[model samples]
Target: MISKIYSSSSIYFSTDDKIDFFGPKCTREPSYNYKLSGKQDGDGGFWNTFYELDFYIIHNCTNHGAKMRQIRRNTQYAPASALFVEIKPWNSSITNQGQETAEFF
Candidate 1:
């Protein structure tokens, strides 16, 4: 995914502007964490703490695997861009059922 972003454009983050919260800095190469593209705390932060619930997310866990993703649309900058994601779990087992699972979070 990161490769695709860099291959498509020249908007990669610079060494001086690289985000190092995840690891060593000095991004001589383009990297992606998408989180690094935005603030992670306070106002305007990614997943803005002010309106956490405003960003809707869905997590589905099943016998195959688990998926967690968020969708944001109709924002100030972009007219219509949707961000979706999925995950393949290595190991997982059902811990709750139906309504009980929803209430836990």
Candidate 2:
């Protein structure tokens, strides 16, 4: 996914720009402890920290993916274009399931 984003025409980055693939620094106790001694804190488990970071990455990816889709459609298809593309009512069913899983996590 990071490679795709980097290679995409819609994405641009400067030399000074830094992309932390995992979103940002983990300042939580579990992450700090795990990194320091390869052990998670008793109260704040590593899995919890991992879940938060995963959520952050997923949220950003979803937003950017939607924006890129919209941009591609705008550039490749005109409003007056008579393209015969089949639309499916269940196209979003998978996305809905993913959202439900994310919420459950």
Candidate 3:
């Protein structure tokens, strides 16, 4: 299996664990809609902008999936740059559909 990784500060919310992608104070809000990419130990650093469809929250995991919805020409932030990504819990049901269907048969 391929291992994918991501870099992000641990998310802290005042309410339930359910984080809202568009809510106030969210790190992924419009003004802060930027994310970082690349391997953590190597020379991996890049930035990408966010859009309406690039929003999601993952549970029980930190890694997220992203698409380059918008590209920016500026790199003023440099190494401190970040990239917002959409994350969701791995759906076991979706992953095990084949076995589940066989059991039903």
TM-score-wise, the better of 1 and 2 is: 1
Estimate the TM-score of every prediction.
0.16, 0.15, 0.15
lDDT of 1 by residue, 1-105 (tens): 111011011224521222112222223333223232222222223432221112212224233443332222212221112243221212222222122123211
Off by over 4 Å in 1: 1-54, 61-64, 76-105
Ranking under lDDT, best-scoring first?
3, 1, 2
Top lDDT prediction, candidate number: 3
Residue 20 of model 3 has an lDDT of: 28
Residue by residue across 1-105, what tens digits does model 3's lDDT show?
A: 111222332224422221222222223222233332332222232433222122232221123432112211211222423343334323231111111111100
| Candidate 1 whole-model C-alpha lDDT, 0 to 1 | 0.23
Per-prediction backbone clash count: 0, 0, 6
Candidate 1: deviation at residue 67, Å? 2.2
Task: Please report, in order, the local distance difference test score of every candidate based on alpha carbons.
Answer: 0.23, 0.19, 0.24
Q: In model 1, which range of ten residues has the least summed lDDT?
A: 1-10
Query: In candidate 3, what residue range of length 10 has the lowest lDDT sum?
Result: 96-105
The alpha-carbon lDDT assigned to residue 67 of candidate 1 equals 37
Off by over 4 Å in 2: 1-21, 24-38, 43-57, 62-97, 100-105
Q: Which pairs clash in the backbone of model 1?
A: none
Global fold similarity of model 1 (TM-score): 0.16
> Can you write out model 2's per-residue Cα lDDT over 22-79, one digit (the tens) per residue?
2223232322211111111222133222211111112212433432111111112112
| Candidate 2 TM-score, true structure as reference | 0.15
